[model samples]
Target chain A: METFQHSFPSRPLAWPADRSWALAGVVGSGNLEVLIEPNPAAPDAVAYDLQTSIPGYADSWKAALADFAAHYAVGGTRITLHDQGAAPVVITMRLRQALDLLTPAQP
Target chain B: MSRVPYHELKARERLAAIVDPGSFAEILPPPARVMSPYLPKLGIPVAFDDGLAIGRATIDGKPIYLAAQTGQFVGGSVGEVHSAKLVGLLKAAARDRLPCVLLIESGGVRLHEGSSGEIGIAEAIRAVFACRAAGAPVIAVIGSDIGAYGGMGILSACCDFRVMTEHGRLGISGPIVIEKWMGKAAYDSADRALVWKTSGGKTRYLLGDANALVNDDTAAVRAGIARLLGPASPVTLAAIEARQAELAARLEQFAAVTSPEAIWQARGVTDPAAATLDDAETFVASLAPAAP
Candidate 1:
């Protein structure tokens, strides 16, 4: 029922120098999934697009995405989030969690 | 103070109370804080484990993997994190050769998350069968009022056994939905007695869908759990065929009957009112073995 948009800055991801797209999640109630794909159009910025059912927390979402982009080196990827009323805290956590799973920090 | 009684215990508390004391070791604790990726735009409150509590525990010293749905949080619906936790837990049970006990209280897939919960439930079903194929037991407990509906109901049906209480209910679509679909003349949701007769524990027991019917009391539930802990029901092809044949016959027999009470009478349950009032023990003893 609500929609929001934001973009974050980050260094380009370090893949095997090959893969183009990586997606995670399906559309469901009370939850939304994210799909991160490689977008060469804007290598310096990771564009974020979000659509949700439970509206009125755009600022919180922006903060979460902004923080995630700043922390992760996921520049060339465009992250699209589809959510259905998940909490702001959960959104931030899941975005970070997904990124962590995709790109683990070196030991 | 806790607003609810035994039923009020969150998923974890329920698990702890039923399982052997101190035997529950949570797989991924809240400190891990695994949550749903969706919902913030909608402004929903997120639980620590995304509303599902999964862990390893023992009941009557029988090792089992326990997963309980938190109905309070989003109707205990499954989202990505919740579903993944469940899938992972089932996989763990399959790998460990442990029986899996699901304290089902979900309203099916979480609609807020969309198709992710739906697909996750399907995956969980496959996982359940995998465990069954591996000789691991998967027991579904429908003690909560939510019982299981939607995709979760089908998953519960696929389970080896279902244990329920008079307060418990099970069906693919809830009475409200059915009533809406059928209209008040066809099905009345507010008719509590009618609803119970249609899908309540006693009805399910008479129909043979519910393996055991216990009282609302926790002690009775615990006893029922202890009784069924020894064996996991595996759904082999032969068993499925047999069940299909049997269910087909029952449907044929009762499909034409508009009154649930009539079905009860034909099932050899004399005085439907008397039978409904009987406690779990009496109810089980009073009934004749299901007609072939």
Candidate 2:
């Protein structure tokens, strides 16, 4: 497995006072699971810890995550992913889904 | 009205859909990220829940502990953390005197983890008996196509009651293994009908293995679970002896039987073909109540 840690700058993620975490997707062939948890210790960036079965995709992962951070308010949280060769599109969707589930709905 | 097929639902989705709405309180959820420590070393991608999503939940307004296995994850094989969660949940049910439900969808032990998975299944089996002895019914739902196999089949058999569906199967050695061992002429795994008849819910329910057989829909499965939520059968010497004798009698009676059809016919399924085509509700209705 290729495991790595990275952080991207983004707007402060608004979290719910009642919830601790949110999760989306499952770790399977061509799929992955995204786990988002509060990271009060780091309030200005979204930290990522990723482990993928198919290695040599670090650049693509970083680019996708960086784009997600820029597009959404996901700072101040730690997202951990367990992937099994999911495509880039699927990964982006799972990250967004996890973040959406973690944060409360906006007006 | 048609409903979401329970077999198609994932582990967490099964828990959320079957139990009372918003009743699932996960013990060690994904965010906890209690992943497999061994998978990474083997260059295998790990699941945050270790392929078993276990937690507290309510069924029909009655509090119960529930666990759902993710069949997509290495065939929902039981590894260290996965089986440990099962043991912990069953133990908690025993301590609290609450019923425990297992929505099992596994092919057996995770072969990738080796003996760790095997030992874990053994521990989980012990915990199942512990809960049963405590008068806390350990109800298993063998309603997924993956069904219970290997150690899981043994564990499920230990449960106080089992709810199965037409899609579910329960057996130690699945068709492929039997076919490989006995040769194609003896047992053809490619024959889907023969395979299902051999191990599927209908035959098992007819043989008194599965306590309940319902439709594949989540709603039907939920109702099936609700029906078996009452008192558990006491684990006593007399019960064990009687069960053993019954099994022995069944084996002796069907020892020479060549097909599952004959077994079904012997069990009073007058038209095995017609009975096989019947839905879960209709099928059980046409037969005598399964042995206790």
Candidate 3:
């Protein structure tokens, strides 16, 4: 619900040999989706751009993104989120989930 | 309680009827008060609950995730938060590998929110496909007269199956819009019978678009959904090609036909008049493709 944006620095992702992009979440009420795609231009700085309807807590959004970037090695990717009113917890969780799905730490 | 028309029933009531008695455990219940953020901006009163009702329930004792749209609230349209909840529910169904049942009574995307709803629908469609890809069936039940229109119609078509009743109608543009486009002489919106005949459940069923047709009774609708809770029909390249051809043939066959009676006859109703007069049971039995 809060309007926010932040970019965190981490190691570049090990780009998948096959796919181009993957998206999760939907642009619906009280919820937002995250889309991750290969940004060949800047594979070292994972860009996080968020547009939210309920604006106010830009800091909370930044904190969530900072934590997600610090936790995951998603630097080589471009992360775009369309958020409605997701709690900070859900935002972080979805970010992690999308990262895991895209990179799949193990496989 | 049962005397009320299906369309008159609230979203929750519709869900209750289609699922097992006392089996529903609504996730994100109304107490959570997760409602639309855009309605109030447009001076529309927001429902205590979001336009959508979603949760886990059982159909004939088989567990599934159910989603119902509240037509009374904003034509059952999807808004930002509403659509997100829906997407989340479908994803949850995929994660749990459970069947997702949608009681569709929407007029498609909520125009108030503009592109947000449009994008939400596109995302939801992708989520629906994700479930289908994972072998979880997504069933759409269309019994309310509001039926499923606009983008929802195409989404319904993409579902694993659709169940409808005679009162239900499905299409992109509603009769009024069509009438406006073609003028009253070409399509009369006031002619309820003609409207029903064109987009009604019986016609859709006869065209093989509707997988099942039951009475307007909720119990019957529930039973129909129960029958198709497990199978997934992933659209493949070959299947898409076949559907394209079928649709082309349909357009070609109906090109010269202005009235629905002609459509029925073209589809091999020996006596179109009598066939239209027949009840669902007899009409279904009497159906035959026009002799090639």
Candidate 4:
């Protein structure tokens, strides 16, 4: 098992007032889950705390998350990931799904 | 996928088939990422919903809380998080006065997590009774091949009603465990017929352990549940005494019997072979109801 923490600078979040947190995916074989919750203290940073069953992938995880943080307005949220050897595509998809569920859609 | 047998469907698929269209709302859906913290310690894969998918849904426009265990993951075992989810759901059902349905396909507690799983199942059982006391029906659906074993079998017994299919087996000890302890000659696990006769849905129903036996179809299982949705069986002193006497009488009546066929014959099943081969409807119709 491997555990790490990393934070990335990103645009501030446009969180919905009705919701504070959202979760996505399940941690199973070759699958992972992403949980995103509001963090008022870190208004301009997205914190990533991850624990994976498969070790030695910290560099890959950091790269993937950095890319997600750069692309999305996920600032002011704490994202925690529990991974079980999910592919890069699955990880990104779960992150996007969690974020989509967190933010309200435009009418 | 709609043609797929209920016993073959996955946890999510089962939920989709049983609940009303577009009415299912997961309480802590997969997105919640509530993975088990202990699995990683043992170098095992963790499931986001801890191998149990629980949510709220309407059955025939009536509200209910539903839980389905994923047999594909970890043999649908119950761990700390999984059992806690069950307990929470049952308690919520009691508080809300809603029926709770458990689609059980587990081999009971997760041995890896040890005592936590056991304690969680115990807590869930207490919650089951709590729901009963609050006039909320708790239904156990055991239609999968994995069936319910270990503490889960006891938990199923505690529910207000049990809906089982021919593929479902409910017992404390599985055939393999019993064979290991009692030796091959005493109990041959390889003999599927004898094994099923001992603990399968047909045997359980005949023994009065399972309330209803349905076919291996989602529609049949759903219908069985629908029939029992009106009101929960109240747990009164008279009911408890009657149940105790019934169980004791069952033990004494079958004490000298070595084969399931003997019990079937004693129960007025003229041809045990025909009874075993018949489908759920025919099998149920052929049997004599238990004496009051």
What TM-score does each of the candidates earn?
0.72, 0.93, 0.70, 0.76
* Tens digit per residue, CA lDDT, model 2, A1-107: 79889999988876552478888898889999898888888788999999999988888888998999999888789999889999999999998888877776643
Which residue pairs show backbone clashes in model 3? A1-A85, A28-B80, A28-B81, A28-B84, A29-B80, A29-B81, A29-B82, A30-B81
RMSD of each: 10.6, 2.1, 15.1, 5.4
Stretches > 4 Å off in candidate 2: A14-18, A40-44, A104-107, B288-292
Q: Tell me the TM-score of candidate 4's A chain.
A: 0.93
Q: Interface RMSD computed for candidate 3 is what?
A: 11.2
Best by DockQ: 2
Tell me which of candidates 1 and 3 scores higher on TM-score: 1
Note the Cα lDDT for every prediction shown.
0.77, 0.89, 0.77, 0.87
Docking class of 2: medium
Q: Order the candidate numbers by TM-score, best to worst.
A: 2, 4, 1, 3
In model 4, where do residues sit more than 4 Å from their true spots?
Answer: A1-107, B1-3, B288-292
Poorest lDDT segment (10 consecutive residues) of candidate 2 chain B: B283-292
Query: In candidate 4, what are the lDDT values of residues B1-292, reduced to their tens digit?
Result: 3545789887877888888888888888765677688888897766668889899999999999999998766778899999999999999999999999999998889999989998999999999999999999999999988899988999999999999999999999989999999999999999999999889998888888888999888888888999999899999999999999999999999999898899878776789998888988888887646411
Clash count, one per candidate: 22, 1, 8, 5
Ranking 3 against 4 by DockQ, winner: 4
List the DockQ of the predictions in order: 0.03, 0.76, 0.02, 0.26
- Candidate 4 TM-score to native: 0.76
